[model samples]
Target: MTAMPMTDAPAPASGSRPLTRVLIANRGEIALRVIRACRDLGLASVAVYTAADARSAYVELADDAYRLEGTGPQETFLSIPALLAIAHRAGADAVHPGYGYLAESGEFAAAVTAAGLTWVGPSESAITALGDKTGARAVAEAVGAPIARGSAGAVDGVEEALRIAEEIGFPVAVKAVHGGGGRGFRTAADARELPTAFEAASREAAAAFGRGECLIEQQIVAPRHIETQCLADAHGTVRVLSTRDCSLQRRNQKVVEEAPAPGLTAEQEQVLAEASASILSHVGYVGAATCEFLLGADGRLSFMEANARIQVEHTVTEEVTGVDLVAWQLRIAAGERLPEAFPAPRGHAFQFRINAEDPAGGFFPSTGTITACREPAGPGVRMDSGVTEGFHVGTDFDPMLAKLVVTGEDREAALARSRRALDEYRLEGVATLLPLHRALVDAPAFAGSGHTVHTRWLEEDFMPGWTASLTPAEQNGAAAPAEDVEVVVEVDGHRLTVCVPAALAAPPAPERRRSRRISRRGTTVAQDISGLTAPMQGTIVAVDVSPGDRVSAGDRLAVIEAMKMEQPLKAPQDAVVKSVAVAAGAGVRSGDMLIEFED
Candidate 1:
């Protein structure tokens, strides 16, 4: 659709600004998500995009497009002033920050409030108190919700963290009080590792969220991750949608999420619902929010943290509860109350994140132009995707390309349907986790009522050994190396010989980089790293060492930011820094050099 010119209709002269026109301050599926919600409400929509996202599908779907000049999220989506200006330029009276980027930023919310634009999220005070884990734990405790035994609040320093860890016992998790998406979290098994992990987690939190405060929590061994979906209004009414199981994860990032969590008894479910309602009601929370909890296989639950915005896995809850959450968010922001009755969860729902990652290659990003694509459909299947053929997958944002949500009368039926749906999903040019997901749904461990899954279960039990048996061709789409020579000979009576062109073989080079893997022959395989190459594609955020500085085995060399995760490049062994190859803010590709070290 072509862009529509801005209309001059003024906002309603009322208590809260009515969402006549909404300016979307995010990109990808979520931008489309908010736009669709606006369509459902008969509200005009304005969409914004950075230069990189100019060709995005969501950009064209909006009634109006406000083009912003930038490439990365920092200069585009996360720029609050730019978003506010776009809201004004598009004559938008409301702004919706779809989950990532600046979704949980209290400053952004306050700024929107100051600008008199309807911010479709919780109040600034609620976000400030609940967005941080330490603050949320306190609020949960205040409402009589069960939280893990740990620190009173944000710990001051290593000294304070050490004290808390001592009281909580060993194997405690030091987390970024201001962090989300598991970015600035670390686990220390004992006192010897406490200070280092604490310092690292703090630095990462400061680098990512601009806040250095941290909290200590006792690690729940082999615990399932569960979350409750909730909605509150300008009034005091709070509705508990449903609960989800989000324990299938890698590096603390959830990969698969399901609603009406598997093993909880009726009593447990009631307890969860009551506790969530009490917490939100006490905090005076407004709009869509989620309360995360940690549960053991024995059915014990502990509230972990709270997200003040719609979560990535909200679709599964919607599929089960039959609630249009985003629409309710807009309605709630426009001063509407929840419906008198919510449909009790009718069926089981599952959402699998279709990420641009190579599962066999340690789940590293596999970004490029998507050559072809097809999403599953035809009954109980939903694909909330943002890309089509020729879409460029970049590292500037999150790697998830889409989500595949399927529902059935029960968990068994959902699993059966999910298997067929995974087989139907076909995409090329960019590697995906389809194969891994297919295996998971087909595995017996996930049969009947589904199985218990913990946070580390995927990485620990599934990923490592699963990939070893597959040939390189089966893992990556790469075909086997061509044979050295091809010969054609007639064996019947006539002798005829033809020699075809052939590839070469050589002695393998020594392993020196993160990408190198030992061949089956025990030969050291080189992975094309010239000198101190980058492990992944991202912009350099910091360069710590000089050309001639001596460094230890664990000294930090530099920091690279990709997909909101900060990857620190540390020296593998003691050496002198021969030369610094890249400067801060320079974008580097996988296997591109960042620093060279002299042995």
Candidate 2:
């Protein structure tokens, strides 16, 4: 492979007009994060939100806020037109697309530039080139970065995919060309599973990304998922930040990330860092980016893909490097050059994604209002959040409610801090990953043992002990007094002695019947709706009814955007639409009137 010729042009000089106003074209913790950075830099901050996120903390903290059309990601955050309009209306000089949504979208980047706004990210060309997995593989190979063995480009269909799978050997991975976050990905152990895996992956890819093209690659069993944070300037200067180990993952999404990977030999660390820098220079990459790689059991590192925007796990890298990546992104986009040399990372750090998910029940997504929230504090702890007590954790966007980050002098210290932080973190009104993370950090396997990404998910020994170690007091409510036991009870002639001390035997609280009330005095009730209420909070993406429209049971009424997933609210009974309460692009809360049915 021929090396791409390096351009000799010096980095662009910093813009004459410093950033005055910045608009965050994203939601959740990341949006709040950018707003805080703007505050530190003395720049005015603007937040754009869908109706679903109007109450988010980020919106309240911003200097100005705009309501975008549509409740879902596609209609709000990912809508290029909506974002540009917000930037223009807010008089924002720069637009920051936080990670996820359109953060890596080349089209959005170009649009921002065309609108004469600073795009606080990598160049559109670089994003487009590296966004496609197959194209990225080619680039990595060309730059002498190790790439996984696979088909040269996207496979045509099941037959082509099968052929590639066979050539790559059994246990291959079928991945979407435009996929991220582990969506549109599947693995097949052998030829028999190829067809099914291919069809499923293709359908998912088409639905998730509107792309059906896929590529086959050899699945690296027992591989550690590691990535290096890289920064570059327009002058072509690239520097490698500290490396992160994101091995604790579920369903291809990282749950915990730690910086300065543990158990790596000095030589291996240097090699990985250099390789990452080389690739960034080759691509003329600018802004903050992460180069993902799979460290195989044989100690060989294979480049996976390059994330063309700031990563969710970047906070961990920040704790170690003492560099604000988001700020650097803003500086780079404004044509400022990086420092002459990169500084070595200083301590160990870890970040845990606090998501509203139930680990006991298959990690199913949970959404509701956060009735109580108590964040961890003390030395070495930092919290980045989008919600507060009373803020609804609706189904309108990603389930991640906050990020808990900690830093320490070494890995053990970081681990201890993480454990303490998780123990102190309290959230109610919705299930969260706190319990799961606490259990994980306390486990013997995770305490000091080095494990890979695959090890956490596939290793048999690591699964059973997660919930087993919980004490009765921890599993239930607060501990009961020792004297509170010793009572005699008889059931079916069998006598049982139960002891309850005075301290523990408090009088039972009175139970009050919940009042069922519907308030419609001020608001007009739609007369023509016979559909089930939306099961979650979301933005209406597609409205299938209008006033006086007829519908049948099971008919699709509207598609709601929640947690980045689209769910259709269907008619529960046949009825005529007396009035449609919601229009496409409107946000709705659970039990919010959508359409009225004629009686």
Instruction: Report RMSD (Å) for each prediction in the order shown.
Output: 6.8, 10.7
lDDT of 2 by residue, 1-599 (tens): 11111122234455323566889988889999998877766678899887777788888988999999775567777789988988998888888888874888888888998899888887788887888898799888887888888999889988898888777798898888885776667788899988867766675566567687889999998788888998888777888888988888775667888898877778778778887888777777888989989888898888988898899999988999899998778767766778887678888998999998655433546787888888999999999988899987766568898999999998888889987888788887887777668767755555656543453462244543333224334334454343233345799999975544535544521111111112112111122245446555666767877888888876777766556544456676688888787887787776787877887
lDDT measured at residue 15 in model 1 versus the true structure, 0 to 100: 59
Show how many residue pairs clash in every candidate, following the order shown: 0, 26
lDDT of candidates 1 onward, in order: 0.79, 0.75
The most accurate candidate by lDDT is 1
lDDT, residue 96, model 2: 88
Which candidate number has the best TM-score?
Answer: 1
- Tens digits of per-residue lDDT, candidate 1, 1-599, equal 33222232233224565567889888899899989988877788899987777788899989899888776777788899898998998888888999974789999999998998889898889898888987888888888888889988889999988888988898998999985877778889999999978877887788678888889999888888888999998777899989999988886888899988888888888878888888888778999999888886667889988888999999999999889999888888887767777898989999999998766655666678888787889899998998998898888888899999999998888888998898788777776777678767755555544585688788777675554224334444444333323243587877764333342213332111111232221111122222367767887877889988987765677877776666566666677888888998898888787788765
Model 1: runs farther than 4 Å from truth? Answer: 1-14, 447-450, 468-526, 540-559, 568-590, 595-599
